[model samples]
Target: MHKIEELKIWKKSIKLTMLVYQLITALPSNEKYGLISQIKRSSVSIPSNIAEGAGRNSNKEFKHFLSIANGSAYELHTQLILTIELGLISKEKVQPVLDLITEVQKMNYSFQKSLETKISILNTQS
Candidate 1:
C-alpha cells in the first residue's frame, strides 16, 4: 500500500475540496438540496477516493479508486459549469475551482497511466 499523505495528487485534491467548500458557501439557499449538494459530494469524492485507493493492497486497486476520483472531478466540473450557466454563481467565482479540477483530472490521468505501466511490467515478469 502507498502512503496517501505523501501523494501530491491527494494533497492537491484535498486543497481542491477545501476551496470548493469555501466557494459553495455563497451559493443560493434554494440550491442547498440541488446543485450545491452534488458539488459537495463530487468535491469530497476526489480526495476521499484517493485516500481509499492508497490504503488498498495493490496498485490495481489504487488505480481503480483514482479512476473513480477522476470521474468525480469531471462530475464536479460539469456541475460548476451548470452553476455558472444558471447564474447561480458568477464565472469569476467558479473559475478557480474549475481550473483546479482540471489540474486534478490531468494528474489523475497521468497517475493512472503510470499505474498501468507498472501493472504491465509485473504481468510481463510473471
Candidate 2:
C-alpha cells in the first residue's frame, strides 16, 4: 500500500477539494441542489478516490481508483466552467481552481503511467 500523505497528487487533490468548497459558498442558493451539489460531490471524489487507491493492495487497483479520481477532476473542470458560463462566478475567481485541477489531472496521468509500467514489468516476469 502507498502512503497517501506522501503522494503529491493526493495532496493536490485535497487542496483542490478545499478550494471547491470555498468556491461553492459564493454560488446562488437556488443552485444548492443543482450545480452546487454536483460540484461538491465531484470535488470530494478526487481526493477520496486517491486515498482509497492508496489503501489498496495492488498497483492495478490503485490505478483503477486514480482513473476514477481523474474522471472526477474532469467532471469538476466542466462544472467550474458551467459556473462561469452561467454567470454564477467570475472567471478570475475560478481560474486558479481550474488551474489546480489541471495540475491534479496531469499528475494523475503521470502516476497512472508509472503504475502501468510496473504492472507490465510484473506481468512479464510472471
Candidate 3:
C-alpha cells in the first residue's frame, strides 16, 4: 500500500521517461553513447528508483529511494541543459523537458517529506 505506484509522482515519472526516450532517439548518431545514453539512464532511473523505494517495508527506506530518484531528476535536468547548450536540442524542446524535471523534483520532494513524517510518527510511537 505504500508503493509509489499509487502516487501521482510515479505516474508522471513514467510519462516523463517515455517522453525522454522519444526525444533522445531523435538525437544525432554522434551522441548515441554520450548525451543519448546519459539522458536515458537518468530518465529511467527516476521511475525505477521511485518504484524500488516504494517496495521497501519502512518509511525511511522509501524516503531513501525517493531521494535517489530526486538525484536522478537533477541529473536529467543537467543533461537537458547540456543538450540545449550543445545545440543538440532546440530551446523550445528544452523548456518542456525542464518543466517535467521541475514537476518530478517537486513530487519526489513531497514523497520524501511524507515518508519522513511517517517515520517520525512511528519513531515516537515506539
Residues 18-96, model 2: lDDT tens digits = 9999989999999999999999999999999999999999999999999999999999999999999999999999999
> lDDT of candidate 3 vs native?
0.87
Which RMSD values do the candidates have, in order? 0.6, 0.6, 1.1
Model 3, total clashes:
0
Model 2 clash pairs are: none
- Candidate 3 structure quality by residue, lDDT tens digits, 6-117: 7899999999998898787767999998888899999999999889877888778888888989999999999988988988888786788789889989978877887788
Candidate 3 C-alpha error for residue 61, in Å: 0.3
lDDT of each: 0.95, 0.97, 0.87
Candidate numbers sorted by TM-score from highest down? 2, 1, 3
**Total residue pair clashes for candidate 2:** 0
Cα lDDT tens digits, model 1, 1-126, are 988889999999999999999999989999999999999999999999999999999889999999999999999999999999998889999999899999999999999999999999999999
| Candidate 3 Cα misplacement greater than 4 A, ranges | none
Residue pair clashes in candidate 3: none
Please list the residue runs of candidate 2 whose C-alpha ends up more than 4 Å from where it truly belongs after superposition: none
Candidate 2, residue 70: Cα displacement in angstroms equals 0.5
User: How well does candidate 2 score on lDDT at residue 50?
Assistant: 96
- TM-scores for all predictions: 0.98, 0.98, 0.95
